[model samples]
Target chain A: MASSDILLSVRDLRIAFHGVEAVRGVSFDVRPREVLALVGESGAGKSLTARALLGMAPRGATVNGEIRLDGSPDLAAARGRRISLVPQDALSALSPVHPVGDQLAAAVRSVHRVSRREARARAVAALDRVGIPDAARRARAHPHEYSGGMRQRAVIAMATLNEPDLVVADEPTTALDAERREQVLRVLSEQREAVGAALLLVTHDLDVVRDHADRVLVMYAGRTSELGPTHTVLGQPRAPYTAGLLASLPQDGPRRRRLPTLPGTPPAPGELPPGCAFAPRCPLATDHCRSEEPETRELDGRLVACHHPDRIPDDTATLFEEEQPA
Target chain B: MTHLLDVRDLVVHYGTVTAVDGVSLTLEPGETLALDGPSGCGKSTTALAVLQLRRPDAGEVRFEGVELTSLTERELRPLRPRMQPVFQDPYGSLNPRHRIRDAVAEPLKVQGRWTEADGPTRVAELLDRVGLAPSYGARRPHELSGGQCQRAGIARALASDPRLLVLDEPVSALDPSVRAGVLNLLADLQDDLGLGYLFICHDRAVVRHFADRVVEMRDGRLVT
Candidate 1:
């Protein structure tokens, strides 16, 4: 992770809607050909962070951040060209009426000035690269006509068509079935190298995060809770939010009476409590945690925003039992 | 108890395309049968056919040993009360205009399970059973989160006192952290109610954890 190898660097990024901070002081970097995952529950600002990278933040939002794309120092100028976005909801991400091929060609032409025929040809190649079979014929089909998985691939093809230096895919595998999820994840991992672009995969899929992502950034209530290599983070999460999330996942072992859930829902952006927003829900929260926000600190090899970054002992059952839903 | 739901050689066609081809599955009381597959693999069409939302081109759907395929809509009304569906998109499936209380009680009222007094009480009880607070009964679908709306959807379906619940990707719309809660709730509900479930989902991991029997579908047919 050399500085120069980083394709996109986000420092002290803050996004707010109507004076409500949705993403507050989040920071991370996406390195070339690396797959980095941003994981969190809804309202954790993962989507907003990804949106900010593409300069596609919703209307009436105040954003202040230093986002360096390919060392260019500004994402606004690089978005849709050096940087690309593969949005959630493939059906809606694509134009329902337009042929998938034409939409992809439009994306290609957006970055590079090319003839319609050349762009269409490139679009077909891109679709084929993503493993959409019968690319030429399928590209001719409308978004509605293509299957759910195909629609996702077509969208992905459009994102990576220009071989952008950075790609931010928001919930790419969501709303898809197991096989299709695997297919989409495979396409993303493959395309990261083939296109030589860094991937900022924003998803809640822990399975994918563990298997596909090189590094992981865990968010909680509009803040960076943990940022580390996937193995280190998922294997031994230092942040209570990350640990609680891992603890809550239903495993293949035995079925529990109820899931080990983090108490209370994520705070709404505007209504977020003072101090650490997650203090109310954190099992390890202290008096200090309730009175003051925890500053991001360097733990062994990662950044952890927690008063107690010491790894919780692996009592397993008791650790899960301690955090009963409030 | 005998099989609560039984499907035989079910086939659904969309013109020239065979959406669900010769698929057969059965559900025993208190058992969860997960139909796991990718998109466009006919898992949904099979669920729809089994629920009689759509007619099958071939094969039979029998509920409690009675043939559902040949029954007319009017004739199917009584039997319909024994089978209810919890759909995929809670935001889309739950009526935006109706409050949770009304939505849940509507099913009971349709089935004549309540008089005036029992309806509200029953709605409250159903809401409680689905882990929703009684206060939530007053809120509309739009006021609730995705998980809350899904819980309301489940509460509505449970209002019919159905022995079989056809849950179509019920937790897929929910956030991952919320998904476990819903799944645990569904599993708990099955234990308490002795409900049979046709859990149609694409997540194999979920099926492995939740389903007693899993039938994987690929391209309109079962792989195993």
Candidate 2:
């Protein structure tokens, strides 16, 4: 793809906390109005990677990389106007003191030179657009008064109120159950589409990635494990870690006594193994894998960071056994 | 044999609002019975009533052929240890100030089952059984990962040697990889100990995979 075709480009993004690198040399791009999912377990640096895009890395953290917005490289000036965030905690994104609608109107007035009445009307319409029933009345209520699902929707509305080119949502639906999760995700996707914004969605839910994301970037430890189209990557995974994660998922099928789990936990930052960060737990790890860190290489129409991508078994379900006595 | 747990006409009310209405269920030993539903649908309320943590407004909770609703506080004291609850938020469920070892040993010490000679050994055994390392017992709840903290919570529940475990969204708060490990541990524990599980979960995939039978709840009533 051409450089101009990308909405946002990140090159060798590195985030470090007190000299210990957590997100090490990760790189990817957000295409124009596309949903790119950043997926991994806790401590995998997916959240930090997303935060770095908005120049919102944690206090005292050192971030070094190239984050360019349409070849401009000025994220701070373009944060709310061109790239907005829908954080995991909806309450934190909203003010408990102000009515939800007023907060959204304030967000609008900050970016655009609009009258208060016009902004308030736009706020209520935005709320209504996200399926918040009685948007006018509910907009007058504080965020604490809104139900959990409604509070989440209000945040979604607030994020897209400015109609940014990119929306970075970090685990927006993690706290919700099945029904509420679907509702919130639908509203988020719909609002993003209505605003014509690409999404940098950071979540641990593979089902959400499969259903919503156009492309997926699977991170392990702090590096890219795989990056490809959602169906191709999830259906025929080229990375061992990705396959192990998929195999562990409980599907709607005949129940099994045990799930195929990765043997060890993800290594803590600054404590990674000699070669691959996932080598200790990877079933396909060989001596070569243990000695040399594999760079991101193109294979099977996707990017996989593994020396033996083709050696991944056809049936990844049997990759790792629990090794228990019956 | 009597059913391990039998709840009949269970009703819980928060002031004027009825949370769980006329819910009935039965679980046999070594079986997992899931109460599946959306949020605010009274799944946790029913579990609390079964555990007698929240006395139902009206119901009959018969555990091991004994009607618990008729029991007084003193009468219910002994039965409390037999039915334990594993909550959703692993860190919130455990004390932040207490060491993981102390948390696990609390139930043993409370029930007058602890001895100076074997208490520490028993704590070590419980931690090992739940896939936690011995060194982890020295740390507080915040120091451990979510999955490890949940295992610590499970070890604490197992310290009571309960006949029934009221697992309320035990794995939902965990990551998928970690959730699978916890679920596997629960399955192994139930099989080896012949314990019954009153599993309350909102994830349908997890309910279908983990439970022997599932009852769907909506508006405080069973849909099926």
Candidate 3:
């Protein structure tokens, strides 16, 4: 991808608190109108990385490295105008006091010099676009009156009201159930396409990443594990951690007595191992893997950070075949 | 023989709204019966009714040939330990201020079964069975990871020596990697103890994989 094609460029970005790094040297590019997913287990710093894009890293945390948006490093000024954030909790993102439409109108007026009537009109239209039924009348009610799914749609409408170049959704559908999760994702994608904005989706659900993401950036202990096109990476993972994660997922085929679990837990931030952070849990870990940190390099048509990417089999199921119940 | 859990015509109403209407289910001993549904479908409500935490408006919840809905709170007290609940949010299930050791031992203590000599040993055993190390018992809920905290919650549930476990979205809040470990632990425990599981979850994939038989619920009623 050319520099001109890149909507957002993050290079060697690091986020830390009290001198302990949590997001360490991660790099990625979000192309125009593309869905780039950041996937990992808890404490992977995927959320922190997503937050850093909008300059919303928690207070007292230090962020270092380059975060250029269309050749400009001024993310602070670009917030809400060029970039928007749809947080995990829709209820928290919206205010309980104001009417749903009023809050969205306020958001519209926050960046643009539109009149109150125009802002309100755009808010209702935005609500309609996200498939909130009876959006006109429903907009007059408080957020407390709307259902959970409706509140989520209202939050998405609020995020895209300004028609930003990029929208960062951090676990947007995690709180919802299976049916609602798919519905919200559908509405989000529809709204994104309508606005012509790229999406930075941060989620731990691999199935969601598989279905929606154009490209995936797998993170582990605040470092990139694998980065590539969704099908290519998920179908044939080049990294051991990615393979283990994909294999562990409950497939839609015949039911098995046991799932292929990756043994042990992800190491917590600040308690990371010396070398490759995933070495402790990875089945392919070697003495070299334990001693030397693997740099993110192109391998098998994708970026993988592992010493033995070649050792990982195309069929991840083989790694756990012995553990499979006969 | 009577079923391990026999819930018939279960009806739970919140004011005018019916939360669970005429929901019926049965589970044999050592069987896994899943109640699969979307949110607000009364899965949790049914579980609560089964455990007698929330009294159903109309129903017969027979556990081991005993109808629990008609039982007095005092009468139900002794049978409470025989059936336990493992909830969705692991962190919320365990008390934040209590140590894992104390949390697990509380059940024994509450039922007047705790002894100074054997209580600590029993708690440690429970923790070990749940794949938690002995040292983890010293930590509070916040200090442990989500998966470990959930294990502590399971160990606490096990301390009661329950025959039936009501698992409501047990692994839904956990990451995929951690969820598999917990599911494996549940399977192993069921195999060893022959415990009946009333598994309530919204994830269809997990339900299909884990449950021997699954009943779908929608709008407070069972669907085909």
Best by DockQ: 3
Error of 1 at A278 (Å): 2.0
Candidate 3's DockQ: 0.79
Off by over 4 Å in 3: A321-326
Per-model TM against the reference: 0.93, 0.98, 0.98
Taking the tens digit of each residue's C-alpha lDDT, what string does model 2 give over A1-326?
Answer: 58779999999999999999999999898999999999999999999999989889999889998999998787889987899999998987888899999999999999899999999999999999999899999999998899889999999999998999999999999889899999999999999999999999999999999999999999998899999999989989999999988887886667876776766689999888998889899878999989999999999889999998998888776776666675
Which docking band does candidate 1 fall into?
Answer: medium
lDDT of 1 at A66: 90
In model 3, the Cα lDDT at residue B206 comes to 90
- The 10-residue segment of model 1 chain A with minimum total lDDT is A316-325
Arrange candidates by lDDT, descending: 2, 3, 1
Per-residue error at A9 for model 2, in Å? 0.4
Q: Model 3, range B28-74, lDDT digits (tens) per residue?
A: 87999999989999999999999999999998999999999999999
Candidates' RMSD to native: 2.5, 1.2, 1.3
Q: Given candidate 2, what's the lDDT at residue A135? A: 93
> Which pairs in model 2 have colliding backbones?
none
Off by over 4 Å in 2: A324-326
**Model 2 reproduces what portion of true contacts?**
0.68
